[model samples]
Target: MAEASYPEDLLYHPEHDWTKIADGVATFGITWYAQDALGEVVFFDPPEVGSSVTAGQSYAEVESVKAVSDVFAPLSGEIVEVNTALGDTPEAINDDPYGAGWMVKVSLSEESEQESLLDRAAYVASLT
Candidate 1:
């Protein structure tokens, strides 16, 4: 399982999604907290590329041994890439949530939506 960590360079949404932005694209994944809560992941049905996703919306779903949960979009964007590897190795979400588990990368559609996201400190604080 992934050790609990909230990377400093990333932003967080209250729904337990994390964001890593580079150029105009942003990568998204569930936080360590979200995966831990879900237990061992067994399936991940990712959205198709070229789809538009809005911030605070559910774009996909992850099924763990314990439950199925929606994967929320942390920013508004048009999807550019998806980690297809997760289809065969969904456990990567629990094993390396921030790395191998990244779900989607999107070309951001609304830059201003980022301001609503929390930083590492604020996100961790929200957990309390």
Candidate 2:
């Protein structure tokens, strides 16, 4: 695996999830560091669109050739959409964890929750 990159535009959970907020909705995905650790992702099991997800909780699962890992929610919200494309090409997670690998979009229950997440610098420091 190569050195992982954390984008400054996103907030991060210590568990290696990233959240991109926009217009009360948040896009969620596992970080590059996470996918590298998980190995080649073989499956993505996502929650339903109408389902709720709580901050600091697992909302879905990604199975890799090495193991199955829980994908955590970085904010509390109702799921608005899931990345169905992952069902066919799970390796997109390993290839593009921040872009094509994005798992879900959510309508946030508490916008202020964003304050609790780590910035890119902090997350990179945590990795060290």
Predicted candidate 1, C-alpha RMSD: 0.8
Tens digits of lDDT, candidate 2, 14-90: 99999999999999999999998898899999899999999999999999877889999999999999999999998
User: How far does residue 67 in candidate 1 sit from its true spot (Å)?
Assistant: 1.4
Tens-digit lDDT string for candidate 1 (1-128):
64699889999999999999999999999999999999999999999999999999999999987788999999999999999999999999999999999999999999889999999999999999
- Global lDDT scores for all candidate models: 0.95, 0.94
**Candidate 2 versus the native: TM-score?**
0.97
Instruction: Work out the TM-score per prediction.
Output: 0.98, 0.97
Cα miss at 45, model 1 (Å)? 0.2
